[model samples]
Target: MTIKELETRTGMTRANIRFYENEGLIAPSRLPNGYRDYSERDVHKLLKIKLLRRLQISLSDIKAIVRGNRLLDEVLEVQLQTLQQAQEDMSLAASVCETMLADHVAFSELNAMQYLMTIETGARERRSDYFEVKGDELPQVHQPWRRFFARFFDMMLYSSLWSASMMLFFNQNPSLQSDASSIIEGFIVLMIMLFVEPVWLHFFGTTPGKALLGLKVESDDGGRLTYGQGVARTWGIIGKGLGYNIPFYNLYRIWKSYRMCSDLETLPWDEDIAYTLKDSKKYRYVTYIGGIALLIFMLYTATAMKLLPPNRGDLTVADFAENYNYYLKYFQMDSDQYYLDDNGQWAEQEQNGSTVYLGIGFSERPVFTYEVVNGTLVAVGFETHIVGEERWVGSNDQYMVLSGLAFANGQKTVGLYSKLSQELVNAIDSHTFESFEFSQDGIQMRADVTYAGYNDFDSGVLIPMDGASSFTYDLLYEIRSNNE
Candidate 1:
């Protein structure tokens, strides 16, 4: 169709139609010959434009309304307001014209008055049509669990009540210097509730905070959370936290956190909603509070523990010393070289691939003894005597304990332990027997031991001993002596 045809249909001049195109109100095609090619769609648009113009809608608003960008209800509401203004302008014009006609004003003056009244009345009827909705009309929904958690957890935990509780717990006990271990335990528990719980609830069946916040967990498929889902989310947190908090393990956690967050964002929501922290509502306040609270709690715990009293009555100074010597004698082990298989099992690097054993056990008070079976000694139990420091170490496949002792000669002793075995006896015998530390229940001693050879004597792995060789291997293990 030609612009002339649109002009004939809408009664708008061709120049006006061209003007509308220049204003970006409409777009008409052009033929190969450069002639304007207006389609039926263009005719419809022009008809709509003429209708809106009759209603006094501005070109910009008419464009938006025609594009279906503005909601129908919204446009109708503006039209209603415009109608009301037009009615008011008509009434005002009738009154002004009546006064001019009755005053017998000069014909020229009356014409001028009539002209001015027409302009003023028309202006009065022209309402400012807004393309946006009124603020009050906007709708809001309940905050998501992630968003809520990002808000309240920090405020509650870091509150005066929580801090005071920690301060009181610490002040009552001396010799309980806040160490890495104690701080970690408290933090792990708190995080399991605050950070981990919400995520777990979303991935699992329910989390306490989510429950309180009326949130529900679901798989990407929208299926209910399975037991396995719960465990994965729960333990995933434990594993991730350990990786982040533990020495070396934490580096892996940090890297995993970043990768997981990035990957989660890109995951197809239609396929899955296993969102990471990044998916939680975009609010930063809750996350900031949680992070700050964690830091404060850690520092406060450490400072409070330092000010607390030692757990002195668990064992006397003398008895502690005797038990210390006994453990130092047996639990230590010597090894030439250790091999860690791809499966994560630790065995002697020899062709036989024998497993090493380093076991330690506690006897009566003043008689602490240990045996090294499998696994290296990481820490002694005596170090934990300060209270809240008696921590355990473990790999995915196994766990270990560190025992404590104070020697009879006023020297402190601590020992490392595992299951009982000849391999452990041999490792103990290979030590150089150098220096030692005291503990309430045992003593810790490190010495150099030469590896005689590898052997398997009912032990998964054994390192043979050549009569008391010296190559100091630091031993760490924990003992929970019933004697205490």
Candidate 2:
């Protein structure tokens, strides 16, 4: 059947059917004539969409309700509760209105009735039946620590095996540098360490860690965790382990926290829908719709790219800078200002008589700042931040990328400084170094050491490095500094 037939059968207009098609409520293939060919599935979907529309559900909300993974019984219970609530609200409103009109109605009582009506109208309509576990649902019956350790052993064993394999493979390919290979190896290991356990549990119901400790992650209501819930939990675990726990990446968590707080302050009462089990089908439908939409989009993109003129792989930074707004929006980067405040212009904000000026970089994740202390080099601070910049290939086309150092007492002069690695000890070429870099990786100082401090080797206190390593601990340096 064509879309017309579907419309006729469903008593929906052709435009409405087409609108549903565009919304991904139903997917119909194109016929040879370039017209939509609707199937039985399309008819059924239209019926469902119509029913859901009558219930005053948004498309996205309908999608979630239809695509949910909750059990059938759970879904029915949630639906029953929602209907009951709606009935009670309607009854309450009717009772209040009758009381106001029939008996003595005070001005204050009218305001209360209006407020109650507003709440009843604005209350969350929960169509999806699924609840996140509370803290008490911690499932402490199984020793989490023991399970973690046992899983750690398994992870270690696999890690060693993978490491050995990598070594052998890279050894055969002598061209691969230790630095590059290590980065790649580290990434792969991190991926495995992060996802392998959760994936294993997702597939086999228990990871080696959980199995060894005789632990199982069950739903709070004693049901198996829905696939979506399991995946969400897995992602949560992955974020905590990789994004928050690592050194440089740990700053991301702080940034996230700040952003979350800011958002709460700005829009504390943003719209939200509570989902219960009955909405599982809606959720499932939405998942299917999303998948179908994505697949169609991918196909369209591939086809369009193939048919159209190939995108110019060449565009210089200067060229992109002409359309800075376009580039900024595309990459979601914010414009950052870099000032030359050499005469301690911004000294009022200096900490401990040390002034720092920060310049936002191309990579928004890292804020680059040079710290000047008491007419000498102090540190360069790279506060790991997320500016939502897109990673581009080749040299930065629009901006000059430089790590500049300026002296506090001397004439307003700024010079470029080479980035120092965490492990590199000796200076590659002798240049008048001024500042140190402070990032999550490590703290690096200038080549020429100025300050002296005692080194307490054993204690975790701040030890003044006299001559411990090539790069002194006091040396302030940052990686990937950008030119304004």
Candidate 3:
């Protein structure tokens, strides 16, 4: 028989027959001209597939039937149970509709709470079901995969948000990075989960992830949870769901949460929330579609970011100063009182008072500033802050980096500092500060007037000094400042 004959005999469309053939459910011999030549076996198999499909038997089971691995009665038993369960669900839905119709409930008033109350009332009257122990104990039961995906979606959302916050909140001083950054990021994620997740459950009874899995959060007593109960349920899952990066505790929570999501029994948190999960496949095939969409979104973002080139590694400070935006990617930097000049270099808004420049280095995080006097890079400097101390070290020291006082890596990172000079420091210390200038390696150093804080030297902090260094002033400062 030809495909048209097979289609007519099986009462299935040609497209449907072709799909089953493509799925490897039925194979027909190819004629010499390359056209399909269906046999009686193909027709018989299609009929069996069609019948089982009407009974809602899975294709895999039908394959077993076609291969003679299982009897129709054996397969029908499982189908019968599924049909019975579906019938019960339909009866419950019909009852709810009947109640609404009896109460003259308006379509606008037919919300989740109304349906919930209707179902609970019906279940109680029949003595067939209990919300706490009989049905799903929580909204996430038997849905480990959906729970895993919900967390994945959440983490991906937070990862992108945190990456953006590197510019949003900390764009001014990223070098302040510490353990506190992680805590703040976690807090932000928590707030979003609370706002978006619970509100969604309140209205729809399913999260975006669970909606795809055809799962809904069933209420505790047939009616919906009170506002407090909703909060408890949301936090019970999410609060205990994440462990704030607690060493092995986070992993343990993930594993335990996964188990709770998959198990039929109530989780420890369920005692507080008092809810269970129920299948709502009739709502839609959302999980599959949503999962695929989310997967695509993640891949696109990751690929786009990975394809971009990294910061300009070869550009010098002078080169960056000439056109900062060209190499802006390299600097993990933000400033509140800094603006770009026509030359594109960063300019400070105020020059009279001390201003600290904090930034992430090409190496480690560093805090420092460059001294500028009368439009000259007089001497670049670095500073080390002791949290409880009142004073700053490397505050005025120009030989800081080469002397091992503020170095990162080795010579490769020297460009991160200003030109080294001892003449300027000596002039300031001896109260001989006057308008004088000297040039070295095309960079200049100069001081305007006498220093006022020389008497404060007794309380000064010592900067690191290297006995043997290649700095032009390493030996000069070592011999001169050793006695000071």
Per-candidate TM-scores read 0.24, 0.27, 0.41
The numbered model that scores best in TM-score is 3
- Report the number of the highest-lDDT candidate: 3
Order candidates by TM-score, high to low: 3, 2, 1
Worst 10 residues of 1 by lDDT: 393-402
Residue-level error in angstroms, candidate 3, position 186: 1.7
Q: Could you tell me how far off, in angstroms, the CA of residue 86 lies in candidate 2 after the best superposition?
A: 1.3
**Considering lDDT, where higher is better, how would the candidates rank from best to worst?**
3, 1, 2
lDDT (tens digit, per residue) of candidate 2 on 262-329 = 44321111111111121223444454445445544544433322221111122222222222222222
Cα-based lDDT at residue 351, candidate 1: 52
Of the two candidates 2 and 3, the one with more favorable lDDT, higher being better, is 3
Candidate with better TM-score, 1 vs 3:
3
Candidate 3 is scored at a TM of 0.41
List runs of model 2 lying over 4 Å from the truth.
55-74, 104-263, 267-484
Please give, for residues 436-482, the per-residue lDDT of candidate 3 as tens digits: 44443333334332222222243333232334232111111111111
For residues 1-484, could you state the per-residue lDDT of candidate 1 as single tens digits? Answer: 8878888977899888998888777888889999988888877877877887887777777767767778656876888887887676666668667877787788665567555755565665564222123633212212333434632443344343344544455332222435875555545555544454444554554553343333455666556555555545545554653342465676676455545444542211112333223233434445455555675676555544322223223344333433332233222321344322222223344557666632222211111233322332223222111111122211100112112222212222222321122232333434212222223433333322222232324333333345533322222333333222
Who is ahead in lDDT, 1 or 3? Answer: 3
